[model samples]
Target chain A: MQIFHRSTNTISRATIFGAVFVVAALFWVAATVQRSPYVTYAGVARPQPAPFSHQHHVAGLGIDCRYCHTSVETSSFAGIPPTKTCMNCHSQIWTNAAMLEPVRESYRSGKSLVWNRVNDLPDFVYFNHSIHINKGVGCNTCHGPVDRMPLMYNYASLQMEWCLDCHRAPEKYLRPREQVFNMRYQEPSSSQPVLVDGQPYTDQLSLGMDLVKKYKLRTATDIMSCSTCHR
Target chain B: MRNCRKISLLGALMLLLAGCRQDMHDQPRFKPLAESDFYADLRSARTPVEGTVARGQLHEDTYFYTGKIGNNPGDFMPFPVTEEVLARGRERFDIFCAPCHSRLGDGNGFVPSRGFPRKPPSYHSERLRKAPLGYFFDVISNGFGIMPDYASQIPARDRWCIIAYVRALQLSQNATMADVPSGEKVPSELPRFEEPGSGATLPVVEPKSANSAPEEPK
Candidate 1:
């Protein structure tokens, strides 16, 4: 009876230890499985259906950003051009080109080309292009050298600080309308006087500064109001 | 034993906290809708409110007419289209208007080139040719049929600028040496509308007999 009692006690202790180990293992597996996005490491390397060159269209061809991305100047999403827009020229122009295959495929399929977004912000942040563009923020100011980019990538970190810095002081970034797409943001060289139609023209209207002056923003604190960006 | 007791107490406390719900959301409530007098005025305001006194810039007296081609009362109103203003207008027009309206004001623009179903109005059309400068201004300011209001995209000065540019476009296509400023350097090759290869030739419409009546000043 003494031996049986000792055996029972040993069995109970072993069972408790085993149960604890099982629970710990289960907890660890659940934690690992619950890690936010379900995407695998290799999914980051997924290929785009077609290769589109912003540089070729913008800088080389002189097509305005508004031409393709119609909604940039008006809405939240700088909307992608529809397949019909592509087919307009492509039907007669480049019927045989492989790069434009997806465009043709979309035209035939009657489905949108799921172009992957490169410059994605966090879900909470709301950004509008019209307000910024209207306030004299150049395309290059935020989008970087979009005119020169072959496959556009996010140029700015797009972090809150990156945005807040410009909102805090927009004067430094202001340039002539001609220099909207000029990525270097170089001012007119001193040696060469800027002439428009054989007449000397100095840019008197600093749009950003004009706005700041018009609003009479008393302090840096005043300019950085939550509504300026958050809204 | 102590650990078991602690676990039970923790679970019970969590359950008690979760069970304790407030009726804040479902409760009947009444409060003032606005915090300011301005807001109250906005909410309580009636339509056809008395027109506010005009402030800042005063608009020049002008009338806009569509249809028929001929000078009438207040026809060809004089507007000071300075070179600086024209240049600014040209830049804005090139950026905004040139795509759909075309650089020469012909309906055959880049939008049509990209297969947009609706083509813009041609400045060459007699209806537009006879239209007052203010008509074009109004069109750019408030938009015509099927056209979106460009007022938001363009400022008041810029709208005036576009009007000047449109006049320039019309003048370039239709003007003779008499229209050119004397002693002023003119481009040897005046800009002209190129007939689009794919575009069907639209027949010019004749003016109605009613338009021949004596002009009345508005």
Candidate 2:
């Protein structure tokens, strides 16, 4: 009738309960950690039709971001370069390489190579590349050293909280207009004054604040509002 | 019996939790260019009603939009070229045109050098140097040969700026010593040598050939 004869040496009820609780807690922790963007998205390079190396193109050759993502400043989407853009170089440089067969096929067939999206946001979020780019948010701030990426991956969490963190205080992330595309641009030390139009502004905070005012940026409250992104 | 019931209940709870995903990604929507039976044209996207123009899209200036005066390409820019305009043009050209035409307008851009079918004609060429401002604009608006039209990517004003910058580049490459301003001095030769006080020495690199004899370090 009994599953096992209860003996004095058998495991205690308290110990069994404690063991179950620990197992459940550990399982929950493991699940939560796996779902975190750091584990799930960041540093995980999605496979692409072409093994394009941003490191070789952007860092090695000093090709500009706008050269490939042609509509970064003009459109909501940072447009992917067409096959012709690839042929503009590949048709000559590595003409017979096996690696570029897909690129050549895409060009010949007039079908776009489906590049896997690395930095995918949920369909609901209305992110605008032009507004962020033109407003002085550096590409590095969100993309996290794309020039050095051999294969591109999602760099930021793209979570609501992560977005609100920047939306709430954009000044910290702001860079000079020219340095927006400079992947290696460093934030000036607090003691070092950044000279803008011959006037020295001490530190990045003051410079960012001055830029915010100059650029006529909306305050955190307005930017962080639900409709600002959700719509 | 109690243990069996408990295990079953826990498994059922887990299964229930697994089924509770909010499917926001599966929302009903018409995809771009997706066929729709609701429309008579069998298209999800409806064509603009006859001659209906969207607000702020009324292109009143024909010359600005078309880059032509009647049938001929206009000889002049729609707006006066300024320092700001040229700067804007340079930025846009470097982004859009420089990939093929090159930063120097030499037709030896990274793209063409790699393996493109045809290299674009250099702006410094005599034919292009003599090309009217509108001719460049027309080429940009209506693509010439394999070059795609950039009308959608570049605005009319930016196109004009690109033309101005191209002209500036043409002038720069073809300039004589007299073209230099009175106060500014043109260097007789390009400064080739590095400064003596640079302090950095070039690292002695070995030849990659396995059979080559190693040389003593300088």
Candidate 3:
């Protein structure tokens, strides 16, 4: 050990101290990168076969979500619209448009047009759309402002922590069952008090709390149990 | 440099571990409507084999399924209509039928407005207003002229529910105040719009309270 100069001790100590900071910074970078759009694809729009605009269909055309997503209220999978649903109006309205050629071809060939999945979840998560819909959870609560999305994108990080935030306290986001499909639904406010059973609520907490009781939502502890989503 | 060799070997091991990180997140089984390479069609969801029926899908009640008695459309609902039934009917109708047949059942819906070629007939018209409940149900199950069949999309029970709502709309357009029963209010409270709760704490707003709102500017 004496073969090295006394200055080596100082250098060694500085290196040791710097390693702690370097490790911390590396961990911080790792976490930052994990949650970033690059990893989670949260705000990024995935390419689809066609540039179908939810903004135009939902907001512009005033089409209800259930019109195309028929089994949303009954099944775990929000049934994707078959080629027939697109042809419902497109068959008459935009029959010759070049943009709709894929849809037209799918109809003629009797082959399904494979639309890209935008909000795919890991296979481990057993999320049920019908249960959430029945429990008075708004579609926008998780899907975000779908009426404003020109091209579909995942609005939230589909992470466990993101899901647990709602599972821990669902009352914070619960809306009336009727407002579940309404993308333009607003939270309770003094100016626009939400009426439930003819009893107007001026605050979201009071309204949500009431909805929790009325909807018979399971306790936070029960929903928070790992099995709730994992199974 | 033996140390250098050891470090390089460690790095190789780490790279091997990283490359093997494909388990758990996506398991072996397919998700709903996922693409499958195993099948020629590339569809994970397969249709039921021909002439085979799943459990509970026998469709025992012929009237409920077809909305017909012996070939002609029947004149009744499969079940008694309730406030809840009508509420569900209205919700379902607004989703499925209102595009071409407007929410008002006036054939002035957004789809028709956008040149849907054939405007759906108004439910309020004499020909449609007099149409039996089963007739409407038949039209929904089997496609009417220019309209596609909705049998696959809407369940049988919901078809009946929609027919009930359509009848309600028909009566609403031609109804007089006298049609309401005595002592019962005209423009009754829509029980569905009531705020969610146990519904035990407060009664619905009285008719007078609703009428007491400030009048619209002339």
Candidate 4:
């Protein structure tokens, strides 16, 4: 026992206290990393086979979201437009543009041009686009300023915590059903009042809370339950 | 004995670490449009087998699906046209048809202006005004002239809705002052827009004056 100096005891005691801080620091780092773009790919524009701009098609041409995503109202998956959809316009306009070659080739060869999944979720989480859409969630509410996007990217972290934040308090973001697809839909304000069921509201909270009751949204506890998203 | 026990404990810890695999995050099931290695095409979602129809999708209502009575287009709707139906029709029409036909059905939509050679016919034309609703439905179901069949993009019910709206549009264009009901003002307040036709958004349009016909695109 005498082989080590008395200072070794002080060093060992300091190491034990520092170990607690070290573990906590590791946990904090892990959490920050998990939510960062490095882990969730949020806010990062992914490279697709074609650099399709939503700004050009949606905002510029005033195309509705339903034009390409045909089954958003009816199905769990918001239907990706088949290559035929691209060809619908591309066949006539921009026929020889080098940028449209992937679309043209996919149309000609009949092989699917693998577009990168911008807002992919884990295999465990079950999401339904129709139910959320029918319940008066705006496309921009979750997707963010899609009309302004030159290239597509996921706007949210797509994490369990992020899902629960809305599930716990969806009334905060509920909008009029008609305004669901409007990319430029603004939150209610004094200058910009929103009408829901013919009653104008100048604030978001009152409109949202009323919409919560009007839309017959599930109870917070029910929506926040474990089985709601994960079976 | 103690050295051997410590080694065993470390081995157990290593085994625990080895269990952290991504099997659950990427389970061996296909999502919609997921890629597959087993299929040569690498498409996980398969097309329906040739000539086979899915159950409950028989689409037995010939008039609903085809809009035809006896090899000729029918003149009426398979379902009752309510305000809700017309609204649905207008929304669908704007998304699908308005790109070429224009919201006015005047054949001056953004797509035609963007070098699309064949301009969609104006609904206000005398021949089109006389055309049966089913004729429009058939044209939307099957390709007509340079236009492609929108059967894949638009469901049957929606295609019917578009026709209903198109009929409304035709009537709106050709109405006489006598068609105005008793007390309503002739020209109610026209919507004011902040800016005219920016490429990003549609400008509020004034109602076309009665004297002005649907002009041909030069």
| lDDT (C-alpha, whole model) for all candidates | 0.58, 0.76, 0.84, 0.85
TM-score of 1: 0.48
Question: How would the docking of model 2 be graded?
Answer: incorrect
Candidate 3, residues A1-231, lDDT tens digits: the string is 579999999999999999999999999998998898887899899888778998888777778888899889989999999999898788789789898899999999988899989898888889899999999998989999988899999999998899999899999999988778877677988766666765667798988899999999999999999999988
TM-score: which is higher, 1 or 2? Answer: 2
Each model: TM-score of chain B?
A: 0.49, 0.70, 0.78, 0.79
Tens digit of lDDT per residue, candidate 2, span A156-192? 8777878998899989888667657767666766443
Task: Give lDDT tens digits, candidate 4, residues A61-177.
Answer: 877788899999999999888999988888999999999999999999999989999998888988999999999998988898888899999999988888888899998899888
| DockQ, Cα level, model 4 | 0.31
Candidate scoring better on DockQ of 1 and 4:
4
- Clashing pairs in model 3, backbone N/Cα/C closer than 3 A: A196-B195, A196-B196, A197-B194, A197-B195, A197-B196, A198-B195
Query: What are the per-candidate TM-scores when only chain A is compared?
Result: 0.67, 0.85, 0.94, 0.92
Model 4 spans > 4 angstroms off? A1-20, B1-20, B194-218
Predicted structure with the largest DockQ when compared to the true one:
4
Give the DockQ-based CAPRI class for model 1: incorrect
List model 1 lDDT by residue over A37-106, tens digit each.
Answer: 3311211223467878776655554456655565666676666666766664466555778888889988
TM-score each candidate: 0.48, 0.75, 0.88, 0.89
Off by over 4 Å in 3: A1-15, B2-20, B180-218
> What DockQ does predicted model 3 obtain?
0.27
User: Cα lDDT of model 1 overall?
Assistant: 0.58
Question: Candidate 2, which segments miss by more than 4 Å at Cα?
Answer: A1-39, A88-95, A190-195, A200-202, B1-22, B30-62, B115-119, B143-149, B176-182, B185-218
Per-residue lDDT of B1-218 in model 2, one digit per residue for the tens? Answer: 99999999999999977866646643456543444678654556565788999887899999998888898888898888898899889878877787778779999866666556778888999899998888899999888876777876678889999999999999999999889989776763333222221111112232333344232111
